[model samples]
Target: MSSPRQQHWENVYSTRQADEVSWFQDDPTLSLDLIARSGISANAPIIDIGGGASVLIDRLLDAGHSALTVLDISHVGLTVAQKRLGDHAGRVTWIAQDVTAWHPPQDAFALWHDRAVFHFLVEAADRAAYVRALDRGLRPGGFVILAPFSLTGPERCSGLLVRRYSAAMLQAELGADYALVNQQPQTHLTPAGNRQDFIWCLFRKSAT
Candidate 1:
């Protein structure tokens, strides 16, 4: 059974080259910078939510992260990423599941990273589900690098409505167990040469 979200993304990946997508980036510089600032070791367990066909996996594998998981709803997107990785694909654990509905492994990831995915949860219930998953997925001392459209960013992307956020808004939404460690504003130049505003937040799960 194909979900509408899955079908839409499947078409997006099938009809467009990975780099041809509007959100495509040759090097995920902002993401890498935030991850580096989190101070996690290269061998730390990490999950890239809604990773799909993003090249973050390539960068992570190159940097020697051992426990890596990439989860997305679209099978086409994941298949393309696996094909791009070739033999290196075996090094990664790929799960094709909707982020809002999937149950994450218990305290499994040292770091959880999401870009553009959070903003897409326009419905309050979906956003709540995302937070629940986050709380369940990360280790107590783990870090989360979340990147979403800022309040000033586009109201819609890829034909879907999005809920933009500031660092403060994101913090409030995630609740008290996660504390904001660092944040940065990014001006991303999409593959189509359009500018998109984004806020990247680094949060640590409280040890208490």
Candidate 2:
């Protein structure tokens, strides 16, 4: 028995071709650039929240990142990625769970990356739960890369409402524990040739 959220994603992945999804990207250039900017070691643990069927993990593995974890609410989405990776998938960890309800290991990851996911949490409580997971799962000096719909982006995606954000709004959500490192705006061209605005931010957790 899947929750409404889980069921929605499951249906989406099961019915639609991965590359046809609005968020599909042939090259995750911005995400890779930010991860490199973080200067984490190849062996450092990194987790991608709501990674779904994204090929970012494939790129990370190719770059010699040995410790990689991808968490998505839809099993079908995870399966799509796993199948695409073939045997290489065994080297990565796949977790099928919702970010808001997840209980991640304490200080388990050196970096956390999310793209086009945070904005979907239109509810304040859901955002708080996600932050709690981030606080608990990330190391003291971990890096966080979050990309959400920009203020000028769509108010809805995949038939669900979303909350657009600015860099300041994102910083407020993370609170004082994380220091904003940098931010950039991107105009993403979807598979359907639609343009979507996204704001990407990098933050470092307090070492204390």
How many clashing pairs per prediction, in order? 0, 0
Runs in model 2 deviating more than 4 A are none
User: Who wins the lDDT comparison?
Assistant: 2
lDDT score for residue 90 of model 1 = 96
* Pairs in steric clash, model 2: none
Among all windows of 10 consecutive residues in model 1, the one with the lowest summed lDDT is: 17-26
List per-prediction Cα lDDT, in the order shown: 0.92, 0.97
Per-residue CA lDDT of model 1 for 1-208, tens digit only, reads 8889889988898999888887888899988888889899988999999899999999988988888999998899999999999999999999999999989988999999999899999999999999999999898989999999999899999989999999999999999999999999988898889999999999999976
lDDT of model 2 at residue 139? 97
Per-model TM against the reference: 0.98, 0.99
Q: For residues 1-208, write the lDDT of model 2, one tens digit per residue.
A: 7799999999999999999999999999999999999999999999999999999999999999999999999999999999999999999999999999999999999999999999999999999999999999999999999999999999999999999999999999999999999899999999999999999999999999
Per-residue lDDT, model 2, residue 129, is 99
Model 1 TM-score is 0.98
